[model samples]
Target: MRALRYLALAGLLATAGIAVAAPATYQLDPTHTMVLFSWNHFGFSNPSADLNNVQGTLVYDEKDPSKSSVDVTLPLSGLDTFVPKLDEHLKSADFLDATKYPNITFKSTKVSAAGKGKLKVTGDLTVHGVTKPVTLDVTVNKVGDHPMLKVPAVGFDATATLKRSDFGVGAYVPNVSDEIKVRITTEGHAEKK
Candidate 1:
């Protein structure tokens, strides 16, 4: 009877341990993570800008994807339009007002599996001091060991659309097109234990 009771207690403890397993944490690889955005320019061309060196943390739960979360920071200083003059203009008081609000950030509120290797991530995106809820259609590019780095890594491609007016960044609304198409690609490596 004593041995049976001990076995039962051990089994209960094991079950509890499995139920409480924590999600894996990954650190975003700054060099490989970037945001690209484009807007129509005077109905002639679609000009784009790239924001590089994104820093973030991702808590991923493979067993239950809904438990995942993401938090990222994008520095306005990293904004590059390829044209030096445009870069300065974008960071000036007219557009992003980088001097006043230096960083753009996003924090995930919910994560849900959309389909096989896809997810819908809803989060609060803060830009130009305005916070708004935005949803990203995310595709899981790969989740596995890195070939060169030899560490567990994950990759994702996400897209979203927003209006510049919503974030108080509208300068040339109808002319430049207020709607902005945003694409993000990121690679993250597992945090060292």
Candidate 2:
């Protein structure tokens, strides 16, 4: 009886260990995820646009953050500049050419901890049919059960700067500013097991 009890205890401990080390998968909440981009417009003003309805999945490993990964899709149809004419122009052949490349995507190649609650995520960003490696500075906003939904959730904010010329979107170059600043905020909910 003593030997049997010891074996059972060992099995239970091993099971607990595996559970703690496993990564959790979260589906990004479209309503809570948004991407914002800004750039200098003709040196006259800084204009910004917002893209919504983002879809993505995040596999987060709390024990080993390096094992985590991210994949997201941003639809150009959701892009809004607030001004109707400007929005149309941006989507036309002169700029993004939305009809040809309707969606932008990012797939993480590596994830590393930067500091406490921060990370350096390097990924491939595809824009205008060109793919470029980009690194984003990410801050973990929260990682726990959401108050409103009462479900396991994670939130993060990330920022990056990229040159439009690199992605074949350099229509105005120095005039409209080749560099673009991008900010992303996302909340993801874990599917109930």
Candidate 3:
């Protein structure tokens, strides 16, 4: 009986240790993260834009994916569509009105395993002073030590689609394409807890 108790205690301790190491919080590495958006330009061609600034905190639970969470902030001022004139126009009052609504944010409400190495993240997205629910399909590319940064890191590829009219961003809807497809590739470094 004594030996069995000792063994059980050891097993409990080991499980606790594993749980402690399983969950890690990573700070978004802005330099390694990119958010790109694409929309059909009058059904002639798809024009894409890039959002340069992004910062967020991601709590990843490898063992239990349901425990994972994320909160992200994106600045509207980082809009860059390659075309200088169009970029300026996007930031003006006619479109995004970056001066009025300078920031976009997302807070995860639920995180669940979609499939092998994939996560379905449902969250609230706030943009242009409007908040709406958004769902993202995220695939984990890799989760381990980063060679360049020499730190624990996680890389992910995620995609989401949002309607411009839903967020009050209906500038040239239907013509410029109301549906915006967003693609994000991010590599975040784990922060020391």
Local distance difference test, candidate 2? 0.92
Candidate 2 ranges with C-alpha deviation above 4 Å: 1-18
The C-alpha lDDT values of all candidates are 0.93, 0.92, 0.90
Clashes of each: 0, 0, 0
lDDT of 3 at 180: 95
> How big is the RMSD of model 1?
2.0
| lDDT string, candidate 1, 99-164, tens digits | 999999999999999999999999999999999999999999998899888888999999999999
Top of the candidates by lDDT: 1
Model 3 Cα lDDT, one tens digit per residue, 1-193: 9999999999999888563556789999888899999999888999898887798999999878889999999998788898999899888888788899998899999999998999999999998899999999999999999887678999899999999889888887889999999999998897654
Worst 10 residues of 3 by lDDT: 14-23
Candidate 2, residue 3: lDDT: 100
Compared to the true structure, candidate 2 yields what TM-score? Answer: 0.91
Lowest lDDT block of 10, candidate 2: 14-23
Per-residue lDDT value at 82 in model 1: 99
lDDT of 3 at 88: 92
Q: TM-score, each model?
A: 0.93, 0.91, 0.89
Give the winner by TM-score. Answer: 1
